[model samples]
Target: MMNLCYNMGADLWNLLRTGGSEMKLLICVLNDTDKLDELMIKLAEAGVKGATIINSTGMGRTLYNHQESALMNSLRALLDPDRDENKTIFTVVDEAQEKAFHKVMNEVVGDLARPDSGIIFTIPVDSVTGLSK
Candidate 1:
């Protein structure tokens, strides 16, 4: 069974609906910057109409930025010199398309089980507005 996370305080009755099915918010974090274009293509082919992508940095990278010390800097560099940036993609998907969405994500992003590949999850959306059909 897929792990479903509920957004607390979202009115159960106010869900976004299209074609008689509720909508879910699909969030994906990808570590590999080079794969973003391919991922977007897959999402479009899977019927995702729109999505938002934001540049993001992990907690370790944030700490590395704030701390200033020769030894610490050297250690951080050795540990993760690149401090690669990540991308967080968000989109609203119909409940009926959940399985297909997962399939496309897995196909483009590869096995999420492998560390640092990225994470894909869904949250039940109570309501949404300004979405174009």
Candidate 2:
């Protein structure tokens, strides 16, 4: 079983690294939901043809909302509970476009390094079958 798991993991890694086309899956989680529209526009301007967006909540926010601990409740109160939910966007783009994509994201999202702004990351895509232009 261990060998099988290792083999599977290795295969997946290899596939992602050597995918037919140098593709990357970019994911962005935005704390400010109002920016979604502007983000989409920026993405389009950056040459992203397709993407998916979903409403999501962070683990910390979820715990703060559901847990009954006074500490968690107090933390939530301090953090402004209304802005806990975020929008997550996923898009597949050619690896060559990474720099432009990031530039556009920064311009629209205002430096991911800042707290509570959001997070953006990328993963190599091994294969994409049904993506249309």
Q: What C-alpha lDDT do the candidate models reach, one value each?
A: 0.77, 0.79
lDDT for each residue of candidate 1 in 57-84, tens digit (9 for 90 to 100):
8887678577777787678779975555
> Where does candidate 1 clash, by residue pair?
none
- What's the CA error at residue 40 for candidate 2, in Å? 0.5
Task: List ranges where model 1 is wrong by over 4 Å.
Answer: 1-17, 64-83
TM-score of each: 0.71, 0.70
Q: What lDDT score is found at residue 49 in candidate 1?
A: 81
Error of 1 at 15 (Å): 6.7
Q: Which stretches in model 2 have alpha-carbon errors above 4 Å?
A: 1-21, 67-82
User: What tens-digit string does per-residue lDDT give for candidate 2 at 81-102?
Assistant: 6566899888887765667778
Error of 1 at 46 (Å): 1.2
